[model samples]
Every structure is written in C-alpha cells, then in structure tokens.
Target: MTDKVTINIPVQYEAIAFKTKALGFDMPSDLQTGSLLKTLVASKPGGRILELGTGTGLATSWILSGMDNHASLVSVDNNELLINVAKEQLKDNRIEFICGDGYEWIAAYKGASFDLIFADAMPGKYDLFEETFALLKTGGIYFIDDMLPQPNWPEGHAQRVEAFITMLEKRTDLVLTPLNWSTGIIIVTKTSNKI
Candidate 1:
C-alpha cells in the first residue's frame, strides 16, 4: 500500500506554499498535518473553527477546504507579512484573518466558543494552554501539531514537548490521543467545562 496521503487538496494550497517559501517562512504546517486538519474540519459542519497560527495560511487552506458553507474560521498570526501572503491567496467569505498576537486574541475573544481549534502557534499550544482550551465548547476538538522533534526546534524544546504531553495526560476534563504521524499530532476532545 502506498504510504502517501491522498485527499482532495485545497486549490489555493500551492500558491500559499509558494508564497510561504518565497518569504522564507520555514514553520508552515506539513502536508500530513494539513490533511488531518482538513479531515477534522469536515467532521464539524456549520462549525466555528479557530486557527491559532496562520503561517502563510497553509493549514488554513486545508481547513477551509473541509468547511461547509455555513461554517466559518478565524485564523490569527502575529506577523503581518506572513499573514498577508495567506490573505492574498485564500479569498473566501468564510474566513477572517487576524494579523495580531494569538495569545492576546485568545484572552480577549468573547465570541462563541469554537467547535474545532487548530493550535499551530505557541499561544494556544504552549503559552496560554488552559486558557485557550477553555475556549473549546463541550465535545469540541482541539488539534495541535509539532509534537515531534524538528530541525527548527530550539534548544530544550524536546523537554518542553515532553512536559506538555505530561500535562495533557493528566487533564481529566478532556480525552486526548497522541499520534506519532504528521509532525506528531495530538487531538483532544473536551468532555467537560471544568478543568
């Protein structure tokens, strides 16, 4: 069997990838991760999705591809230049791109809770972990990548990854499964509002 992932890729993916490369942004989500995000978004029809990192909108394209017409996405990133690349390529009424700090956005967002959240940035994934998780509705899906070691990982990042995994394992309000594929993903489902 072929090990490659075969799915209907987003039309804007190639352009976004090219812009990301041209801009020298090295942290875009991998193809495998994008595939998973697309699949996960498909599961939530008319869902309100949140993407914590809009790195050239690589993952955003995949998420948008999976969303139904009634669904909407709010993608955030701190870099204006990188986010602009995504805004230029993926033009859909369903998407709202925010060029701002993911951490601050999470803290200040008082809108409806999200059905699915893709935390590819440090805010939702590392910095304000619980606070961001709190934004997930009951039974909502929380997705994050980069759990595995990568060439770009800074020193002591492996230790941080281990610690994050340990913390997730101890959370009783949610159920999580760690996948070794696709840059090492961790998919979590919120079971309760309580921590």
Candidate 2:
C-alpha cells in the first residue's frame, strides 16, 4: 500500500460534505484538491479569486479560510438549490455566491483580472478556455482538476480532455502543466496578456 498521509477534514468541511451527501451530490472536490486550493489561496493573500462551480461550498470554505480579509471570491453555479445550500453553509462576506449559467455569466462579466481562478464548473470543461484565460491577470494561475482517469467518465470524455490539452500545448501566451495528482490537475499560468 502507498504511504500517503490522510489529511483530516476540517469540521466546516465535514458539515458541507454531510449536506452534499444528504442532497445526493457526490461530485464535490476531493480532499487532495481542496487542500491544494487552500495552499494556493494562502499564497495569494489579498488576491482576487474565482470558483466556477460552488458545489456545496466545500471548496469555497477551504478557499475562504485561507484567504485574508482583503481578498474577494466570486463563486457561481447554475443550480439555485445547490447555490443556496452552499451560501447557507458558507456564510462569508468576502464570498459572492451566484446562481446562473456559468457560460453566460463569464460572457457578460467585465470584472478585473483574477489573480487565481478555479474553473471547477461546466465551463471548466475547457469549452471557453480562451475567454477564461483572458480573464486571468498576467502571472495568474488557473486550476482545472478532476482530470484523472475516472472509471465513471462517460464514453469519449477522455478524447475531449486530450484535445483540450493539445490546444493548451500550442498556446504561446500561457504555460500549462498537467500534474498527475489526485484528479490530474492542469495548472495554467498566463505568462502574458496578449492573445
């Protein structure tokens, strides 16, 4: 067996997970990914952060706890029910939980560049990679996880991931690396603002 140390789920996260299970939502970010988010947010301090999918607020809790007061997070979800549950569980002034279509929301959003973005929603599927990349500040990091080979993945899902990776590889403005970690995270950093 591998000697991977088990990280304790914080009580807040446990509550969120409990709620998620009660709602039959089993797709929240795993502990490894959550921990990585915490670490990433912690390093950014007062930077602006965005999460595309606010599933049960489990990952939002992790990000909020790691961020300072000066930082702000905008997390969006299309499901009103899920967004409400997450808002209730994660009562934080710094986080703006939105319920709407992720694609349309990003399409209309003219907000400042984000220092870090967790594209964890349907948009995270890389359909809007170029638009999302443009939202990132130069030197900003974009995280897309749940990429590890999943037995439950629908047929042809792997092909989409492969095509996305290939597209990223050809980009000259950003540096992309696929980390073979928990869910095969593709970490992208915008090296320049040019398209």
Question: Which numbered prediction scores highest in lDDT against the true structure?
Answer: 1
In model 1, which range of ten residues has the least summed lDDT?
1-10
The residue-by-residue lDDT of candidate 1 on 71-189, one tens digit each, is: 99999999999989889998999999999988789899999999999988899998999889989999999998999899999999999999999999998999999999878999999
Identify the runs in model 1 with alpha carbons over 4 angstroms from their true place: none
User: In candidate 1, which residue pairs get closer than 3 Å at backbone N, Cα or C atoms, i.e. clash?
Assistant: none
Error of 2 at 12 (Å): 1.3
Q: Each candidate's lDDT (Cα)? A: 0.91, 0.84
RMSD of 2: 2.0
Q: After TM-score superposition, what is the CA distance of residue 175 in candidate 1 from its true location, in Å?
A: 0.7
> Which candidate number has the best TM-score?
1
Model 2 agreement with the true structure over 109-144: per-residue lDDT tens digits: 998989999988668557677788788899888988
